[model samples]
Target chain A: MSGKLFRNFSFLSATLSFFLLVGIFAILFTYAQDAMHAFGIDFLFNETWEADEDDEGGVFGGFIPIVGTLLSTIIAMVIATPLAMGIAIFLTEIASPKISKGVSVAIELLAAIPSIIYGMWGLFYFAPIVQKTVGGDGVGLLTAGIVLAIMIIPFMASITRDSMNTTPLVLKESAYAMGATKFEVIKDVIMPYAKGGIIGSIILALGRALGETMAVAFLIGSVMSLPHRITDPTTSIPVLLANNFAEAQDLEMSAMYYLALVLFVVSFVIISAAKFYFFGKKAK
Target chain B: MNRLFVNKLILGLSTLSAVIGIGFLFWILITLSYKGITSIHWSTFTNDLVEGGIRNLLVGQFTMAILASFLAVPLGMMAGIYLREYGHGSKLASVIRNLSDVMMSAPSIVIGVFVFALLVDPFGGYNGWAGIVALAIMMIPIIISTTDNMLALVPKELREAGIALGGSKHKIILQIVIKAAKVGITTGILLSFARIIGETAPLLFTSANNQFFTMDLNGQFPSLTVSIYNLATYPDEASRELAWAASFILTMIVLCINLIGRFVIRNKK
Candidate 1:
């Protein structure tokens, strides 16, 4: 191909993400119109998900799944953020070079394991332990959230470590020369310097936890009923779609579309905020 | 003395946290291997799902993943080439870069939903093509980011030498710049391939699940991950064992590919 033609082709390929984003939004919005009109604003609050006797149409709402998604993600973030910070600190501040490198690889390998495996492992071994120690059935919000926390810890720690590693050695030495305690120096120097990236990594992990499907699917119990407690069974939007979207018909199907749209839009906003607002300036 | 105590306490807690992190990794791996190995049989590799073997699921998963790579690699590499070479420092390049980053983290299931609406809803039903498209969508952003970052690592001095040699822009990029970044790009490709192949959510609805071995793209296809999801939930010992076996194999494939990718880059260095 001619150079100009080749360049144009490349440009077209480069624009694919933008078009795909818009296309997904447009298609979901268009498909979701039936639900939008049928339930209107009440769809967010309506609790009962039921079909008419004919199996043709149904009254569907997103509140249970929406709340489930939010609560599970909140639980995950609360659990993950501190642990991830500690791991980052351990890797950057405490470990010797040789030990640090080996641990880093182990953490990355942990991250590489598929989400489905987490789900299976959670269902079998982890859930039983949770059942014995905690109060509820093996699968619930608490179980799902903790396993999800483990899943995202590696990602958050790696990114946080990268940013912490960027702190200048001279700055650290200056703090130490001033007789600052190790904790004090880290809290005063590295924390302030890498605050943006640290927060960015946390938010990014939050976003991942928000939309995670397989792991949460197995652990969340996939019940439509709202959870009465942290250990109670409930379903999230992705789980709801994964299990029910195919069998749904007419208005119920449209409601599923509406849920997917909400998920896509919320994640788009969250990930974009983390990228542009937090990491935008120093990302390169 | 109080300051020293606080430092020691915080340091101890951080060390405990790393231990907890590593502890979970070994816990899962050990459990997976013990269960997987105990359940494996000679027939496990020879039979299809209809006869209770994983041969078809493996083939099906590989077929879709490889086809996705075929679609994504060329398009993603071209996009990366545009970002680093032709559109360097341009307004449009920056915009695409940011969008691709956002796309990278957008939930995989939403991509499945989008593909279902476009390919499955209109085309009548679940098919291999829809599954491939959903996976391709997931793979493209990953490939784009990798290719972009890898190409950016090529030195400016090298490009200047190509220009001094009177090579065309495309020729220089194809022959010199891309060659310089080949190892990094290959590793990226391999890593992305591992990511997409392990995905269960996107294929959950797109390919649904087939009980029999079939190569037809117009019909439902077997998926190892999706089948594991279905089988694990079944209230039977046999199916549960199969699920464990499948999960072990899938994890091994993913982790091995990742190790190989790291090894390749380390060897180059």
Candidate 2:
């Protein structure tokens, strides 16, 4: 009876602990109800962003930041995905064991650097160079994408490297025996086997890039409009949330929650998509 | 016949890509160090943020981090213990694990909004406590994941030994299992510390950066990362210099925590 009671108690604690996430989701969903009714289905379709400063808490639209988030993340993935795969390929195949380990460890350390540092560096050093070559003063959609690309490369490369490393040795040896070149073996054998992980890593990077704040908040020009050009200023969901959450009142605050709910749901889908890649392998 | 050339070309390109990835790290470090060291001074720590010193920001960071640790560790450890010891392989355990994994990658800023709703609004203000709650939530998932993995690594033989000695499940877990897995648990704690210390987004609205230093958890507080963001955006040279200096300080703290965590985990292995 004592053991039974202890077991029940422990289980109860665990169950309660798990509900914290449920609570978070609850609060977000409940608070966002006001804006859901206010904005209706057009919340996403409305392309213009205007927050009335004249009224204490006024009408606002999140469409521009949503666009910015999508655009910047797409740009980052476009730039980082192939480069990250290349780095992974190099680590798993081309580099010597010693050099690979050294570089791999360095990449791990690179991941340890915080998002804020990346933003600061982008705003200071990287943006200036970008300004010189890429046009505008470097604080725009392009700079934000570049910074995010730099930030997510370590994640994408490390995950992909692990996937590549796990490719069966027998398969590769057989490919080599067929008189195939190294490139052929990778393209035909390794990549096909590790495709799930590669896709997962890229999606994971996308999710991170999408929700990234602070760094993008600094580098992205924070203008609330649809960006027609790479050099055009824009905002993202996270940056908008961080920049305005303090002063927001009533409907404005609820609108932020609505935006938060949007971010929450999008990231949830993207993160689960990342898991689909791993679950395929994890099933084995 | 042309396979050798193709192989050589792909290999060179891939290697170059890896070099570029590594190259960015070095360039950032060198530049940050150069800018940080040249501008940092003794007065920087002795004065206020707008005036000079980051003393308040450092204190606030430590306070909020410690508060977060207090909230995160015991709860996370308990949840981990429940998953590993009591509920292992159960449907509930699997569900909890999946949720934890999803939450692990959830956006931090949304967490800010959640805290703003629950704590910031109810408490009637932005204070260090709200920030602590947000950071603690962020810290929780990481600790649960690590603690579950680490506790599982504690050998079954050890648990069997405890059982043979007529030890109860509670005692076995608290004494033998936790003690055996202590190093890994410590590593997880340190890693979570490294994670929370550098986070800016959750704190962006929760702690709500102040220009002056204050020990009051009830008041808006300064933090290193948040200040660095506010500072770096300024167009002037002096504020930019101070921003770099603060970034250096913040980077070093985060790097040291991570390196120490790596060192400890390596030693344990």
The local distance difference test score of model 2 is 0.86
Best by lDDT: 1
By DockQ thresholds, what CAPRI class is model 2? medium
TM-scores of all predicted structures: 0.99, 0.95
Q: After superposition, how far is residue A163 of candidate 1 from its true place, in Å?
A: 0.6
Shares of reference contacts reproduced by the candidates, in order, are 0.85, 0.67
Query: In model 2, which regions exceed 4 Å deviation?
Result: A1-13, A51-58, A281-284
Model 2: per-residue Cα lDDT over A201-231, one tens digit each: 8888888898989889988998887888898
Residue-by-residue lDDT tens digits, candidate 1, B20-124 = 999999999999999999998988899998888899999999999999999999999999999999998888888999888888998999999999999998989
Looking at model 2 chain B, report the run of 10 residues with the lowest lDDT sum: B94-103
- For model 1, the DockQ equals 0.87
Q: Which ranges of candidate 1 are over 4 A from the true structure?
A: A282-284
